[model samples]
Target: MTFKIALIGCGGMGRRHAHGYIELRKYFDTVEMAAVCDVHHDVAGTVAAEIGEATGSTPDIYTDFDEMLGDADLDGIAIVTSTPMHHRFAIKAMEAGLHVITEKPMGLTLKACRQMREVAKKTGMVLAVAENYRRDPMNRLTRALIEAGAIGTPYFALDIGVGSSDGAVMHSTVWRAKKEQAGGAPLDAGVHNADMLIYLLGGVDSVFAEIAINESQRTLRPMNEVAPVLAEMYNHRREDGYDTGDIVEQTAVDTAFAVIRFKSGAIGQLIMTDTSHGQSLGVSTVSGSSGTMYRPRSRSGESPRIVRGDGTEIMGDALLDLVPGFELDDTLSTLWNGARHISSYDMDFRDIDSKILAYEYLDMVQAAESGRQPEVGPQEGMDALALAYALMESGVSKTPVTVEDVAEGRVSEFQDEVDAEMGI
Candidate 1:
């Protein structure tokens, strides 16, 4: 009973998803890679070959999405396309009688998000978003601790991220730097930050943000002098440390700071930047009435810890000891050093971004088979996007924008541009 699935987009993220599918197919016994499609035939063929090598199934490759959809006997389509094409692909695939799971930020606009959600409802198909960050073990642990009152009556937290993308190959692209395509770094990274807020805290009521293009088209002296420093900051190392091109101009708001007012009366201060040097983007701290919980900057390396207001440490050993004989493959497992670790602390968690995608893929496929919705549905993705757009609107208007405004279509210019561009 292997569920046949096709993957769309053959970029960096696409490859990661393919790799996950190959790995999960061995474990799940419920899904199979059927086809790989990209705008470029060679890229699709290349990914198809990789899938073949891993899954022993060489998927058919296609450059045109419609031709692939029409030809393949796929039960679902996993879309990892760029931001602009997400809505287009998801709508068409759902309309064509296929379940859809798309990469995050759901769609560029609230209108587009609603459209996709409506189509899924009408078609009675599974519509899910591959927001791996929400499935990250540390995040789940943090949420569990908060709910357990380790962080009693959560009030405030910091969502801070600072790192230079200058030498990162993914950030050097045009889609990441342009507003029309991806909404730049704000939407690209901010959506994950926003989702964490909602997942742990609650829905955002409003957001007041200040977005800046600080490092716009700046020239560096030379790579030879700063290669070592650049390598440390970006986490990507090479002999020369200069593969992302000499001259880089970022058109998006690379630096953004926002104040999110949660519907539950909690507050979150979000700080994200691609211009900062020698820092990690994943560091987050949540504070409440009684104690605080902190998630480390690196997911694969560190586990989250909680500290009481009186300075009592909730040790990892004690937490792990609380949940004995817990199955690592159970829903209550968290990623610890690339392995599943069970603890009362995490409750149950997941990891490895692609593995998260595989989990979501399996969920969508199972849901399509059983007539249930995925655990992480498109509405959650839309809510996250609402906060993202509110940040942008607040930044542009120099004031706070209510999530309701963005959710109800009061916020329209940027989304309008996206819809017009995509003919949505």
Candidate 2:
């Protein structure tokens, strides 16, 4: 039985998800895109046309989500809307007896995440977070190696990246610059880093952080200079009046430095900034008693390297030897064309990205069908969000904050405004 799913929020990411459904069909014929919905009819119509052209199946388009939910005849829905709407739509869909997979950060705030989780529990609907980073093959291999003791007795990790956005808005979306809409990179892209760290290492205990907005103003990159995809998205936002001008007064924090303590007794330092002036820096390495493992940025398809205390290095196909039984699971193997041991993939950004999202879709569908949890279910999603929020929450009070406290809504100074604004 093919699982019928509909796409909500037909924006840039929504279009990518539509393409993901197209890609999923190449491997598994167990799902179909039944409908598309957006606040803007033209946007939904355009995406519907694209899906039809690519998959030979046109989806019905709707401007109202309730109308689509009532009339689409879908078994599930993919919530690709903005961050604030994630929990709102997921709860409504799940309460309406449909499974939901929403884009991260799972909810507007911890309170919102809890509300969504409660609805899922009461409705028994499968709710998954569309986190694509940990789904990368390289990340899978890194997790396997860590579990196999290749980097024995892990103790600490450093994940740092500093760069200058030069006043350009991220993704050309104005909402991302608004604190009430997004908590900047620390809550936007940082969630991916948080989830990957948790997947590779373990649960985080507490975080002490300093967060700041180094730049309060941003401008749009020239259309010709930006990628075609982003340029098109910017045009759509402008047409829809979501972003009116090239300049945006950013209200979100753009820089963060945090020290994390893991429940496994491992420590981590996370530093992220998009307001640096001159030189840029990046580092991602996990140190253990025996060796240091170098990790590439997630979804980059780059190979991870390990350097032993004796100065010996292992990488590429040789790294697979560290774990004799290392292999992708049956589903991932099928999605990756039966590759068992792969250090890296030879696909472009869009191709690999869509493939990863397709795997996510398949995971959600199978979990809903089998009455199990998706790989990144509500719990995992909430954990990652809590980790990300720990940074902001700690920064707010100028003190270390426990992840548990953040997740349980015991410490929420940073998120209070957003939660209040969202009325959650």
Compare the candidates by TM-score and give the number of the best one: 2
Q: State the RMSD for candidate 1.
A: 5.1
- lDDT by residue (27-59, candidate 2, tens digit) is 888999989998988888888998899888999
In angstroms, how far off is 373's CA in candidate 2?
0.5
Candidate 1 C-alpha lDDT tens digits along 111-154: 88888999999999899888877665556655666776766788
Candidate 1 local lDDT, residue 102: 90
Relative to the true structure, how large is the alpha-carbon lDDT of every model?
Answer: 0.72, 0.86
Output the TM-score of candidate 1. Answer: 0.86
Model 2 has a clash total of: 0
Q: What TM-score against the true fold does each predicted structure earn?
A: 0.86, 0.96
lDDT of 1 at 43: 70
For model 1, what is the C-alpha lDDT against the true structure?
Answer: 0.72
